[model samples]
Each structure stands twice: as C-alpha cells, then as structure tokens.
Target chain A: MQIPAPFEYVRASSVDNALALLDRHGPESRVVAGGHSLLPMMKLRLARPDWLIDINDLFELDYLLVDTVPNNGRVLRIGAMTRHTTLLESDDIKRLFPIVIDAERVIADPIVRNRGTIGGSLCQADPAEDLSTVCHVLEGVAVVRGPAGERMLSMAEFHRGPYETAVAQNELLIEVRVPIRDDSGSAYEKVERRIGDWAVAAAGASVTLAADGTISHVAVGLTAVGLDRNVTEVEAVLVGQAPTEQLFVEAGRLTSLACDPLADQRGPVDYKRHLADELTRRVLRAACRRAAASISDITI
Target chain B: MQISMTINGTFVTHEVEPRVLLVHFIRDDLRLTGTHWGCDTTNCGTCVVLMDGQPVKSCTVLAAMVDGHTITTVEGLANGATLDPVQQGFMEEHGLQCGFCTPGMMLTARALLDHNPHPEPLQIREAISGQICRCTGYATIVRSIQWAAEHPAGAAPETTTSESTEQEVHA
Candidate 1:
C-alpha cells in the first residue's frame, strides 16, 4: 500500500541531460538509477523528493572496462549504472577483483540483482552495505561529474557516512576506478540473517605480496561494525609481515579491537565484534592464499 | 504522464501518475491481477515480473521507468489453452499450498531456465531465495521447477479429480 508522494518524473536521454534535469529541478530532485533502494525509501517517506530524474536510459553509463592509465598501470572502470548481475557474471571482475564477485553474490538475490546497480548501492551508502567495504579494501575511486566537470574521489572521501555520499545534488557518479595491482588478491566475507540480507558484520581484505613473500600492500575494511572507514591498525600489523596463521590471528585480534559495533537485532555488540575479528582473519587468509597463487600464475 | 510498453506480447499505453508502481499499474490499471502484490516492500517476490527477459521486483519499479520496456506477467505464461511447463509442473507437483507466491516463483524459474536451461536443485533454491512462500511449500515448489526443467517443451495439461471437484464446488 506504500507509495511515493506525488512527484514529477523525467527520463534523462544522456548524462548531460541528467545533469541538466537535476539543475532544472534544483534541490528537490533526485536521480534514480536502479530505484531498488531509493523507491523503497521514498515509499517509507524517508526520502521524498519533488522530482525524480530517471537515468535508466543512459546506457553509456553502464559499462565495465579495464583501462590502462598512463603511468598508472591498469584499472577496472565500472560505470555507474552497471547492474549487480553484470558484476557477478563479468569474467574481468572475477579474474581481476574477486572481492567484487564475493560481495555481489550476497548483495541480493538474483531477482533484485537484475535491477540494482553498483552506483545505486554506493549512493545508498547503508552502514551495513557490502560493496562500500569491498571498494575501500580495493582502494577504488569514484568519478563524479557535476555541472563544473568531473572529479575523482577516493573511497574514504566518497562515502561520507551511513546513507550519505559525496555525490552532490546536481552531480552523478559516472564510474568507479579500481587500480589493478600485480601479485595481489582480494576477498570479502559477510554474515547475514538470510540469503540476501544486510551484513551483521562483514570484512574485506586486499593483499599484495612482495617477492620475498611478505605483505607489501594491504587494506582491510569492515562493514556494519560502526567502522566509518578502513582499519589502519590492522593494516599496520600485517604490512611487511609474512602471511601466516599466527600473523592472521594477531591481525584478527587487532581488528576486533579496532572496530566498534552496536547491539541490535542481528546480535549483541560482543557478537558483532567477534564476527569482525573472525571474518577479518578469514578474508586475510583467503586473500593471501590467492595473492600467492597470483604470483605463481605470473611466473608460470 | 503517458507511457507505452509491451506486456505479455501485447502493446499497451496508459496515462498514469509518475508515482504509480508497476505492480499496481499492472493490477489496478491494466486489471492483470495474476501478478500478486505482497509486503509492499521489495523483500517479498510476489510482485516479480519479467523486464527485458529478466525477473525484477515490479513493486520497486516505477511504471514510468518501464515506459518502453517489455514485461511478462503470469498472464503471459500460457498461450490459448496450452500451459507453460512451469504452470503444468506446479499443477503436477502440487506446488502451491496457497497460490500467492506461485506467479513470481514461476517467472523467476522461467528466467533462470532461459539463462541456464538445466540448473541444479541448489541453483533453483538460490534463484527463488529472494521470494517468500509463507505456505512453506518450498520442497514442493523446488520439485515443481525441477519437473518443468524435465519437461522443457511442456506436456499435455491434465485435470486432476480433486481440482475438478474443487472447481465444480466453486461453480
């Protein structure tokens, strides 16, 4: 019985047209890509915009490509309107960043995945959101375009807070760029109430091993655990250290201490902290295993 | 606002308010009530329909968003008196304790079969995981979909005695 309040609808033919519509409608406008999250919120009266600018026609904003940036090596560029199904099925995403696959598989069930977009997920920015943590661990940057032009914002800057993002009222997130590193592997682990529910507490890890079999670059991010951004202390413990069960145990302990989770229906604060610790260790172990395998793949 | 789309192979147009959800538009405006609306929220897949050959929650989609797309509801599953394999499978396997979740489940199964003609039991469960069947007939539902996969071209529709008796009672 829930329905959105009366609002004017306009479909954008292109990205430029989307921006122009946003400007024309002013602050009372919102761009709906997937409408999975926004429409539900609108129904609940959580988000009641005066105008809805539908950008579903902007097919140009739906892409997943690997671009070789000058002096920056190769990076995966995911368009804003790319559906979750595409990410789950993309061989490029599976091979380059398995973390995305890991997260996408559990983001929603197959039906919802057909319509939900990566850009919509990012813009929704729920605290329990999985992809944000995945992007943070992968060090992804967002390409946001406004009337002034485009700006690249790091994951840390792009995600302002729970249900908040850096995408301005008149701007659109055009693409997400994740640098592909050599000898690196990434993974995400989450525990939800059901098959496609929000995470109770999830963790993502990206690890790059040096020639000496030591961690060279590492990033760990946790979801729904009151952690606003990536855990630097966990990274500090694992960096330059050899990948070992004992080392992972230490990292897990550090992760437990670093996160601050609140008690709710999912679990108590203690249970969430426990999940944060265990999931972090699990991801680190899997990531390091894949990282070593990637090195072997290169040499072989 | 005016919108036009293909629903169940039929071209239709309507002047609906911008806020009208596709589920309501299909049922209330077009009088295609076979697509049940449930939970209002997107959690329940009772409002699922095929959009561009993929199953999407119609309750979450605006009618305006589907202005020029194709949608297939349960009404489209059968042609003339011939039933789709999915529909026959349901009848053969007794897939419904209550028929509320049947349409969405069948649409999802159809889409899954289209992409993967032969999905395993676990795959079938995964495909319909988003939907809720309060009847707790998941075991029978999965069996029904499996039966549909076994009969890809569909089989002759047969009327069971109990169903015929129930129909006569209603009549």
Candidate 2:
C-alpha cells in the first residue's frame, strides 16, 4: 500500500507538545487525531502534508463530563478525542441527547465508531454527518486550542463551507460542549445508501415543550442537502402552532426552501431538495412525538 | 524517520520514509507476507495488526507513529510450526476458500476475543465489520471464530494471549 505523501512523523505526548510541534511545522504539518478522515483524503491525493503530528495519544482529550446545571450553565463537556462508540455507549448521552446516541449507533458500524473521533468528525465538517447536524440543533460550541490560546466557536460560525471549518491550521479542537436538556426532546434521523457509507440526508430536531403543551423553543438542523449543513429557523413555525404533520409538512417545505443543494454525481439538485423535505418531515415527526411524550403538565 | 517496532515476536528497527504506512513497513520492508493488503484504506481490515495488543488499520498508521510498540501481525499468530487456535479453527471450519480474508478475519477475531472471550454472534459480526471479504461468504468466517471460542486451546500459548500490552496508547 502506497501512502500518498511524505511527512515527518512526530508523536506528541501532551496537548502542549502537539501545539509546539504544530507551531514549529506550521502549515506543513497535519494533526492526525483518529486519521479516519485525513488518511483517506491523503490516499486520494486531496491533502499532502509533509509533516504529521500524531496527537491521538493525548489522553486528556477523551473525557466525558456530565452534570446538572442551571440556565446557560454547562451541562455536558465532551473531550474532542472521545470516539463515536463512547458516545453511543455513554449513559450521559443517552439520558441527555438520545438523538445523538441514536445517530451514533448507526455511524459506519462498530469498527468505524471505535476509531472515529468526535473531534475529527466535527472538524471534517462532512455535511452528511449526523453529529454535526445534531450539534447545530443543540447549539454546540467547539473549544479549540492553538499556539496562542484557546477559544470557543459555535457550530454555525465554526463551519465556513463544505468540508471547511474555522479551525486554524495550527489549532486543535480540545472540546465540544453540548447543553443537556432535562425534559426537552431531541431526535436525529439519517437516510443512507449503505450500512457503513455516509448519509444521503440527515435531520436533527430539538424541541422544548412548554408547560401549556405548546413549544417553548424549537431548532431544526438539516444536513447532506446543502453546500454546507445548516440549521433553519423553524422556531417561528413551531412556537405556538401544534406540531401536526400538516405544519411539519410546511416546515419541511420551508426547510427545503432554505437549502441550496448542488447537483452531484450521487443525485440531482431537485432530488436532494426532495430528500430535504422528506427527511425534514420524518425527523420533525419523530422529534414532535418525543417532545409530546415529555410534556409533564396538562395546563393548556 | 527511522522507526523501531517488534513484529512477529521479534524486534527489528529500520529507517523508513515518513510516508511509509505501518502496513507497507510490515509487508515490504519487514517481509511479512501474511499481512495482506486488500484496500490500502482503513475500511478494509486486511492490513489490520495488533498495535500494542489493540486492533488498528496499519494502512492508515504511519510506521514512525508506532516506534517501540510491539505489533502482532498475521504472521505472528502461529507459534513456529503450530498454528494459532483462531487460524486452526478457520481451517477446521473451512472459514475461507481463497484465503485472502483469513488473516484480517483472524486478527479481527483475536482482537474481539481478547476483550470479550465469549462473544455473541452479533459481536463476532461487529468485530469483523472493518474487514471486507469477497470470498466464501461471512458465515464460515463467523463460525470459525465461534469454534475458537468453544475450543480455546486448539493451538499453543495460542499466540493471541502472549501480547505484550504493558502500557496502553489512546490510539
């Protein structure tokens, strides 16, 4: 097997050392986490780095912290290096973000999940990834560390375009923070061509039911349908109206309207837009059902 | 970069290019013909090897990244003349026809059995998900793993249990 490009290998024991290596190598070095995304790209000759700073050994970047919190407080802190399998098997993820867990369960099977890191997935910004769309719906923030310091960027602002991210060449994503919901309902659904292949379309919905059985807050993020995955403003339609199939159909239409899927070899633009509407409808219905189940009070 | 790693129970250090994948080092330089390469991508587990006793795709790994690590390839599975239990099980159960997927299947099975000695059918299926076998169907491959699970001592120290996992790496 011929590796695509020549690179200087440097295994850093800690985050600081990795940063130092990146600083020293600058644009020539590629920081490999799980290499689930990078290695494949390298093999295809898309990216050719002369230096690789292997940072997967940085154990500190693999912690999953979960706790009860007040409004605007930290609910969950997931280290970037945590694998998809960990997310699938995590109790905290199951209790807080069942959609994330559910989505992860179907992520490229068990072996890919075992090696695919959350940081790499997020950083890759694959439009079809369920977790990326899930993060967008949950208003997730990526905490990145670089030579200068660390900074947090929201998912919406972090992703610049297709297969692009705001992460600096020298920066390393250290953590991704997702707000935990005690009673809110969130769900993710993906349509795929194969068991281990990337998704054709994925949609995530997070809805908070009010005491009056109406929607308090609603966010919908749709992926694998646009130039870049995006979260549409579905709150206006969801706030007071009943989450009926008819309303979701309208929401799906509007969501599809918000998308700009370019025609690719896999599908035509019209077909992808149709998928956006259908997937949006399915995921919204699923989310509505889950949210309806979480309605504690019958005040309204 | 010059890399040093123990492959097949023997220690050998060699200077290699930085772009040389661990699979290339094992197959070309080290001359271990047993570790086959099907895809040269992580998707195919044909290049799978035990890096510090953990299953990893050698095709995606840089040889220098595994410096000083003890790697167990398919060639390392047998104890000299005696075949490993997993290998013998594959033969006895007729797990393979062309035998191209045998090495990858064995490594995948060995990794799974190491963690969960008694794996369910679903677990066995999941263990070999990384490997892509186009020959003889997966039924026999899965049965061979189950056979090994039943008869643990079909082959010597079995080669699977003698892994030198003194320390753990996150990768």
Q: Which candidate number has the best DockQ?
A: 1
lDDT winner: 1
Deviation in angstroms for B48 in model 1? 0.6
lDDT per residue for candidate 2 within A161-217, as digits (tens), equals: 778899998888998888866457888877777667677777778877766666777
Chain A TM-scores, one per candidate?
A: 0.97, 0.93
Writing each residue's lDDT as its tens digit, candidate 2 over B1-171 gives 677888767889899987777888888898888888877767677778887777888887778778888999998777667566688789879999888878878987887887888999988987787688888679999899998887666633435444222111101
Q: In CAPRI terms, where does candidate 2 land? A: acceptable
Q: List the residue pairs that clash in candidate 1.
A: none
Per-model chain B TM-scores are: 0.90, 0.87
TM-score, second chain, candidate 1: 0.90
In model 1, the runs with Cα more than 4 Å from the true position are A297-300, B156-171
